[model samples]
Structures are given as structure tokens and as C-alpha cells.
Target chain A: MKTLRLLYMAEVKLSVREMSSVIFGILLPVGLMGLMGMFADTQLELIRAFAAIATIGLVSTGIMSLPLSLSSYREKKVLKRYKVTPISPTHLLAAHVLHCFSLSTLSMVLVFLVAWLGFGLEIVGSLWLFLGGYVFVMIAIHSIGMLVASVSPREKTTGAISSALFFPMFLLSGATIPLTILPEFMQTLAQIFPLTHGITILTDIATINEFNTVSFLILFVLTGICLMISVKTFKWE
Target chain B: MGEVIRVSGLTKRFGQKIAVQDLHLSVRAGSIFGLLGSNGAGKSTTIDCMLGTERADAGEIRILGTDPRANRRSLFQHVGVQFQESAFQSGLKVREICEITHSLYENPIDWQKTVAEFELSDKLKTTISDLSGGERQKLCILLAMMGRPKVIFLDELTTGLDPVARRDIWQTLLRLKQTGVTLFLTSHYMDEVEKLCDEILVIKGGKELIRGTAADVVHRTDSENMDEAFVKLVEEGIR
Candidate 1:
């Protein structure tokens, strides 16, 4: 669609024009993974470790940082200008969502490449499963980001709320500490957040042959719910 | 002439504060209409309601003979707007903003003409972050003009600009009117309302205080200028 193209171009231009976000979102993950891989004891350990690192990068970029930037733009009244034009609200939202998702995806690929080439890691499953899990996580997290942006009154508030929401998910999702090490209660609690299911899917793709359909389905449902709430709650003013 | 916009019994409330109350007005096609009120006078609220950006609790709005509430997309093509506090991507240049806006319309105006007329040719490559207040205002006006809508809404359009910049924009607005573009602009400047508007709507505390031609308001009140007439009307209340 012509509208889609315009939205894509706008997103690309806005992101690429200022290289800082790209550095933070795309290159930062790869750099962190490379450093960790160097210190990693073995190829298997490095591959196992990458799930957490990538999750951190993706969550920060897609959930916290991108939403803060957008809400700040709204607080500055930048988004109000679009209201007058023929461009619809859906187009603007789609562009921002695509921008964050693509950058986060690129970061994922870069980190995986480093893990594969630099550390000689092996993925035991179909590449499609890895890609699918990656896409699912990105959409689900991006939807949460939109919900954050929709409710945050100001950019500063967006930053605060995003961090508060993300850090607990980051630590408890079996990404950093394996679920096997956690107590029974904590392990049960982890299932409430999408990151738990998402990391489970990602690790399954990397360490095993088949995808975790239960985890994948749960994540897909969560993504849909977040997206609907985001659309319903978004305020233009 | 056709009625371009009609509002009857429009009211908007945010929690306990009513932003607009029983607002009624009509803007004829191909004419300049001004909304005059001081700060917190509900000028922006009224404009937002008409644009369907703010949902009114009670009322009817017919823009181009269709309900703006239910037919925003169709009405959007016929209406252009610039809000009171507008911002842009600081990295965007004036030329790019114009180009992007031009794409939104089915039949857009010439970007070349827009740039030349707005005197933005020299700043084509200038990023918005580096632009001064007047330059940003110029860009905003240019963005509004690109679509050549049948009606344009400008809220506090000249609040920050210097006199020279304001005059330039006024001239450009007049030129646009020559092409049969109806304008709905809001400002606190009485002289601006008197000079540019064929009819003025004075609002106070979220309601219509007075509506008539500049000369009619002035002559009816025996005031020397529109400002005095406005002050008298607000103080005495609309009888």
C-alpha cells in the first residue's frame, strides 16, 4: 500500500537520521554478546547465555527506549501536527511499531551472527522456529511498549514505568537464571509474563529440534491482548 | 454560498471542567472566519471538537454536509489544521515536511510554489531543531497549505511570530483565499481578527459570546475598535 510505503519511509528516515538509537538498539547487543562470548567457557555456554543478553537488548529497545522517545514526542506536541493532515492515526502508529520492530530484529540477527561465527555456536532446530519466536517476542514486547506510551503522561514518566515493568521480567524469565535453578513458586510465577514464554521458545529453538508450541501459543495470545489494550487506550492529546 | 461547517449545541467536558458549552456557529465556504478569545476561552477546545480530535459530550457538527464524528476520513480531505502547540521531528527539513504533507492529499498544491511563496527555499535543508520560532511557524503554515483543503483551521497561528512574519503569513493566507479556500483561524489579537476575518466569533468561558462582522460588532457597541467592543461584550455578558 502507498500509505504503508510512506510510513515505512518515514520510520526509516527518522531512525537512520539520528544514529544514536541505531547504535544503542542494533550495535549494542552485538557488542555485548561478543564480549560475553569471549569470556564464555564453551560454545554451548555462550549459546545458552545469549538468550538473556538478547532479551535485555530487545526489551530495552522495543519496550522502554522506543516508547519513551515516542511519548516524549507527544509531550512535545509533535504528534498533534499529524492530526490535521490526511494521514490517519493508524498509519502513524504502524510506522513507529515497524521502526522499533525492525531495529530490534536487526539486533537479534547481529547477536545471533556473532554467537554463531565468533563462538561457533550451533542451533539444533529449524531456522524458521527461531525466526518465528523472534518475531513473536518483538511484536508482544512492542505492544507492551505501545500500552506504556498510551498511558504515560509524559516522557519522563514513560521511562520510569517502562523500567519498573521491564526489570522484573528481565530477571525472572529464566533467561539469566535457568528455571531449573528457581524454586517451584518462582517458576510458576514466571509463566504470567510473556518474556518467560518467549525465552522458553527461543531456547527451545536453539537447544532442541522442535518448537515449544504451548509457549508459542501463550505468547501469541498475550501479544494479541496487549495490542488490543494499546489500541483502545491510546490518547492523542 | 455553501455552508462549509455548522455546529449546533456542541459541548465538551473533561471530568468536572467543561471546555466547550452549547457552542453554535457556522462558517460559510470561501471566507475567512476568526475565533477570538483570551487564554482558557475554549478556542482550542472548540476547534478540536470540530476536527473530531476531541469528542463532544453533546452536539451536532456537520462539516461539508456530513457528520464529522462519523465521517472523519472524508472530512479530513476537505479540512487542514495546525494546532496551537505543534512540533515536528527536529531532524526533518522544511522541504521534506512539505513533500510528506503533499502526499496526503488526492490533489496537492505545487510544492515549488509553496516553498517560493512561503520564502522557505533558502531553508530547504535546514533541520527543524535549528529553526527559530518564526521559521517553525512558517513551516507549520506551509504544511497546512500543502493539501489545499476547502477549509483550514489555525489555532493561535501568530502567537510567537514577529510582526513582519505575521504580516507575511497574513498575505499568504489572503492569496490562498483567492483560490476559494475557507479559513478558520483563532487568535487573541484583535487587530488580526479585524484585519483578516470577514466574520469574527468571540468566545468566553467555553461559550459563544458574540458572532458578527468586525464592523458590525464595533458599530453595534459604539466602541472605537474591536478590542474595546470585545471587552464590553465579555463584561456585560451576551444579552
Candidate 2:
């Protein structure tokens, strides 16, 4: 427990010093939420916008910041340094995950406050179920990020792959532009992405007071596959 | 002195390539042991296998009397390793790097004092990626020493060091040995092995070519010097 705490403190320091997670993961989503609040019409529209924009934090931190850090560690041989230490490298990995998770949670809280205060959003739902779904969706998205980091052989490749995944997911997965704005074919194409299902479930649960089982099943299976492949192929050095 | 590290019949293969094969060695307490081999001669591989960086397909390795692979985390508390091509996260400052390493061990040396002793006080605030090669090497050495370990493994201990820095490190290593710390090192410099190592093992193609004192190896190879003996043995696996 002490080692884990030390690792977490070190991770927070190093991560904050870099500021990528803060800027992209936390601040970016908050900024985007403010922009979306300017156009929010009815209470339900404002409430649904919160669901879509909240997942931006997940994509930025999990898919972008998380893998980028791990890949850089591999690229710079930092992971090799941790491998020889008395603490298992997995402990360090947990620290990274925890750091990103905290940032994502913070982003969500800030976004909720902004939507409620700035836009007079009315969220009619089981808050507990919404919280549970939000946590699960965060885990699912992070697993995909871990998968990207695991499979990419180089830091450069990880960046390219992560960016390739990031822009489309952020744009089409309802994190930025609403999926309702897209044409029918584009929405169907967006449905192929795991993150799209995550955002859809969060939106449905928050605004309509219900879960989307099909989207839930899609994210669950995708999360399982991602976690399995990530575990099997993850490289330390 | 007791044997501090023991490797017997150790073999490791990466796909079809035999990286290390049936290699065996032992290092005594309070002594420096060197593993010498040409590039791709499996010297690093042997060190990696022993340090639990890579697992062996066959045989046994006991560092401080426990198998490294099965008990890496616990063993690492009593052991320190300096790799030839590894470094800390580039964004981390030297002081932060030291703190993280210091926190990993059950008991660590006073890293601040050691950093000052190693002439790294000025570099503490510098990000690791900005450090010069020699400075980075010193920081690595400082980190390895943080555990106050019983056995320290150094892979290519003086590869990039200048002549004066190399000699200074050799002296520091000798000083560490005097404190009853066992040293297991790998190097290509014959003079370094001759000067510092009590026992030297030379390997090629993942197999042991020779193991003895520098003079003994020269005598066995019918050569005038350790350098010549190394060349001859590489041409012929053993005398």
C-alpha cells in the first residue's frame, strides 16, 4: 500500500509536469462543454449534451494520454528501468491508470457543474445507475487505450494509431458534434466504434432514465476482447 | 567468501536463435566478476537471464540463494542492476527519479548524499532527457546504489565513459567491493577486466569460451596478454 501510494504520488508529479493529461483530458472537455452550453436549447438537450461531452475526457486520457505515456516509456526505456525495481511494473501501470481515472472523474464533475449551472440542465435519471454506467464506460474506453498501447510496437506508431482512433471517435462518437446531426450512413458508420456505444449508453441513461442493452452488450464484449488482447500482448520493454 | 550468484546449465532461445546456451558461472562475495564477449556474444543475454529480465529455457540461477524469476521483486530489494541501454522517464528530474527509486526499496541509502558524492547535486533539477551521457550514466549508477544492495549487476559498466571517468568509476566500484558488496559486471575492455575483476568469464555465441583469472586465461591460450587471449579464444571457442 505504501509503495502504491508512493508510485501514485510520483505519477501525479510526473504527469502534471507534462500537463498533457491536464490540458487534453481535463481542460479540453471542460472548454468544449462551455462551448456546447452556448447552444443548449431545452433541458433535455442540455442534459444529453453533458452525456456526450463527458466521454471526451475518457478518450483524451485513456486513448491519448495513457498510451502515449506508456509508449514513451517503452521508447525511452523507462519501462525497462521499472522492470528491475523491487516493485512490479504492474504497480507502476496501476498508478498510471489511477492517475488517468482520477482526471477523468474530475473532468466529469466539472462538466456536470458547468452544464447544471451554465445551461440550467435537467437530468432526469437514476443518479446511482448513471454513476455506475459512467464508471463502466470509463473502464471500457481505457481498456481500448491499453489495447492500443500494447499492440503498437513503437511510440511513433502508437501516436499515429492513437490519433487515428482519437479524431474520429471524438468527432463521430458524440463527444463533440452530436450524432443526430450526422446523416444516416455516417451514424451507422459511427456505430462500428466501441466509444460510440459507450456515449450512447451514457446519453440514454442520463436523459431518458434507461439503459440501452444493445449498446451495453456491445461495450461489454468490446471491453472483454480489449482487456484479453492487452494482457496477452503487452510488452514491458 | 560465499558464492553470491550462481548460474548453472542456463539456456535461453529467442525463436530459432540461441541467445545463451548451457552457460554457467559463479561470483564470490566482496569481489568483482566480469563477463566478456564480442558483440552479440550473449554477454548481455546472460546478464539479462540472471537478473530475471529474460527467463532461461533450462538450468538454474540463484542470486543470493533464490531463483530470480520466481522471486524478482523480493530479490531486487537486496540486489541492484544497471543496464547498458535503459533510463528513467525522460520528463522526470534527477531528484524525482531518485525519490521514486528510493521509495521502491525496503531500505535505501541517503540518495542526496550519494548524489553530492557523485557530483550530481547540480543535475538534480535537470530533466533526465537533457542530461549528458556521462551524467545520465552517473545517475543510473546512483539509482542502482540506492538499495545499498548486497549484489549489483552492471551491464557494460564503462561503455560510454571517458578514460578519466572510467577510471574513477573503477575506483568507486573497488571501494564498494571493500564494503562486502559483490559485483557482477560485463565489459569488452580487457584492461578493465584485468585490473578490476577477480574472476573473468568470456563467452561467444551464447556458449562459454573461457572462465578464469586474466593471467590464467592468457596462460591457457598461450598468449602474451589478456586482450590477445580473448581474440584467440573467440576464434577457437576454448583453448
Candidate 3:
């Protein structure tokens, strides 16, 4: 427990020092939310905007930052350095997950506060259910990110692969443009992405109090599969 | 002296190329052992196999009477390694690296003393990437010694240091050798091998060209010194 705590603190401190967390995870999402909420002439538009904007942190951290950081460590041989110690690779992996998850939460909070205080945004459903849904979304997406890191043939290739998947999801998963505003065929195409279902879950729970069991189950099963593969095949160097 | 490490009939191949083939060696306890080889001669691969970071295609290895691949957690507490190319996080401070390494061990020495005695106290707050090459090398050494292991594996231990720093490290290593700690190192510097290694093994093309004391190798090659002996072997062709 103590070792985990120390590793966690070190991971957090290093991430903060890099300034990528504040820039992409926090500032970019918060800035985007502020801009999108401004043109909300009606409550329905405002709700759709928040629904889309809430996931920026999860997508950015899970698909972009997390995999890249792990790949960088491998490229630099930091993971190799850690392998000789008594500290298990499991410890290093767990600390990374916890650190990225917490950063995602902080990013979500800042975005939420902007919606609530600056624009009087309100969540109509149970906050507990919303929280559970939010956590599930994080785990599912983070699992996919970890799986990419595990399966990538080379350290430098992780960036290309992850960025290719990230931008389309970023723009269409409802952040830059709400999924509802798009035409029917594009929304159907967007359904292929994991982020779309995550947005669907958050939107359903926040606005309509509907659980969207299909989307929830998709994310749950995905989290299980990705986590299993990641654990079985992850490499240190 | 009891043998601390043993490798026999070890072979490793990368696709069509055999990196190491049918190699064998043993390091007795409390002696400074050196592995000297040219580039691409599979020195790193052999070390990796011995450390269990890389699997060997054939043969057996035992460190302290246990297989490293199957029993890392229990065995690594008594082992430390300084990799030739491994690095620390660039954003991390020296103290944080020390703290994390100290936490990883089941029984760690007082790292504070290690830092002060090595003259690294003033660099505690400095970022790892900001340290000079020699300073970084010193930091790597400090981290390797944190666990007070029975045996240490050092790859290119003094690749980037001045004369004074290199001699200081040599003195330090010799003192540690007196305290019953086994040292295993790979180096390109013949002078370092002649001055420090109690037993030396020189290899070419991943096969043992010669193994004995520096004096024995000099006598066998009919050379005047360790440098001439090594060059003579290289000129004679390993194949």
C-alpha cells in the first residue's frame, strides 16, 4: 500500500510537471465547453452541448495522453529500468491507471462547474447513477487505450495509431459538434466508436434519467475484454 | 568461493542471425568479473538473458541457485542492475527517483548516506535530464546500490566520466569488492579491466575467444600488455 502511494504521488507529480495534463485534459476541454455553451439559445441546445462537452476529458486522456505517455516510457527505457527491481510491473500499471483516472475526474469537475455556475446547467437524473456511468465510461475507454499500448509493435507507432482514432471521435463524439445535430447516416456511422456510446450513456443519465442498458452493457463488456487482453500481453520494454 | 552466477550452453538468435551461440560462464562470489567485447558481439544480450529480461533459446542459467525468469520477485531483492541504455524519467527529480527505488526494495540501505557519500546531495532537487553525463552516471550508480544486493550487474559502468571521476569510481568499487559484494561489469576500456577485474572474459562474435586473468590472456597471446593482447585476438579473426 505504501509503495503504491509513493508511486502514485510520483506519477502525479511528473504528469503535472509535464504540463500536458493541464493543457489537454483540463484547459482544452474547459475552454471548449465555455465556447459551445455560449450559443445555447434554448435549454435543449444547452443540454445537448453539455452532453457532448462532458466527454472531452475522458477521450483526451484515455485515447491520446495515456497511451502516449506509456509508449514514451518504453521508448526511453524507463520501464526497463523498473523491471530489475522487486517492484512488480503490476504496481507501475496500477499507479498509471489511478493517476490518469483521477486526472480525468478533475477535468470532468472543472467542466461541470463551468456548465453549472456559468450557464446554470442542471442534471435532471440521480447524481449517483451519473457518477457510476461516468466511471464506467472512463474504465472502458482507458482499457482500449491500454490495449493499444500493449499491442503496438513499436513504441513510436503508438502515437500514429492512437491519434488516428482520437480526432474523429473528438469531433464527432459530440464535443466539437453534438451528435444530435448531425444527419442520421453520420450518427449511424458515429455509433461504431466507443466514445459515441459513452456519450450516449452520459447524455441518457444526465438529461432523461434513462439508463440506456444496451450502451451500458457494451461499455461494460468492452472494459472487461480490453482489460483482460492488456493484462495478458502488456510488455515492459 | 561459491559461484554466484552460472550459464551453460546458452544460445540466442535473432531471425537468421545467432546473437549468442553455445556460450557458458560462471562468476564466483565476492570477485570483480569483466565481460569485454566489441559492438554487436552480444554482450548486452548475454547480460539480458542472465538478468531474465530476455529469454534464451537453449541451455540453463542459475543465479544464487534459482532461475531468474521464474523467480524474479524473491530473487531480485538480492540483485541490482545498471543497464547500458536504460533511462529514468526526464521530469523526475533526483530525490524522487531515489525515494521510489528505496521504496521498491524489501530491505534497502539508507539512501541518504549513499547520496551524501557520493556527493549527490546538492543535485537532489535537480531534474534528471538536467544532470551532466557524469552526474547522471553517478546517479545511476547510486540507484543501483540502493538495495545492497549480493551481486550487481553494471553495463558500461564508466562510459562517460573524466579521469578523476573514473578513478574515484574505481576506488569505490574496489572497496565494495572487499566487503564480500560480487561485481559483474561489461566495459570497452582495457585499462579498467586490467586494474579492477579479478577474472576477465573476452568474447568475439558472441563466442568466448579467451577467459582467464588479464596476465594469462597476455601470456597466451604473446603480447606485452592487455591492450595488445585484445587487439591481437581481434586481428586473428573470431570466426
Ranking by TM-score: 3, 2, 1
Q: What would the TM-scores of all predictions be? A: 0.90, 0.94, 0.95
Output the lDDT of residue A173, model 3: 72
- Looking at model 1 chain A, which ten-residue stretch has the lowest summed lDDT? A81-90
- Model 1 segments more than 4 A misplaced: A17-20, A76-83, A167-193, A213-218, B235-239
Candidate DockQ values, in order, are 0.47, 0.63, 0.73
Any runs in candidate 3 off by more than 4 Å, and if so which? none
| Ranking of candidates on DockQ, top first | 3, 2, 1
- Give RMSD to native, each candidate: 2.9, 2.1, 1.9
Model 1: docking quality category? acceptable
Q: lDDT tens string, model 1, B1-239?
A: 99998999999998999988998999999999998877888988888889877889999998889877687766778788888776665576666666667778887888887778677788988887777777778777777876668888888888988899888778878888898999999987788888899999888889887789999999888899998998888787742
Task: At residue B19, give the lDDT of candidate 1.
Answer: 86
Expressed as tens digits, the lDDT of each residue in A26-107 for candidate 1 is 6766787888788788655676667656665577667766687688768766676666566665666677777777778777
lDDT (C-alpha) at residue A77 in model 2: 68
Best by TM-score: 3
Higher DockQ: candidate 1 or 3? 3
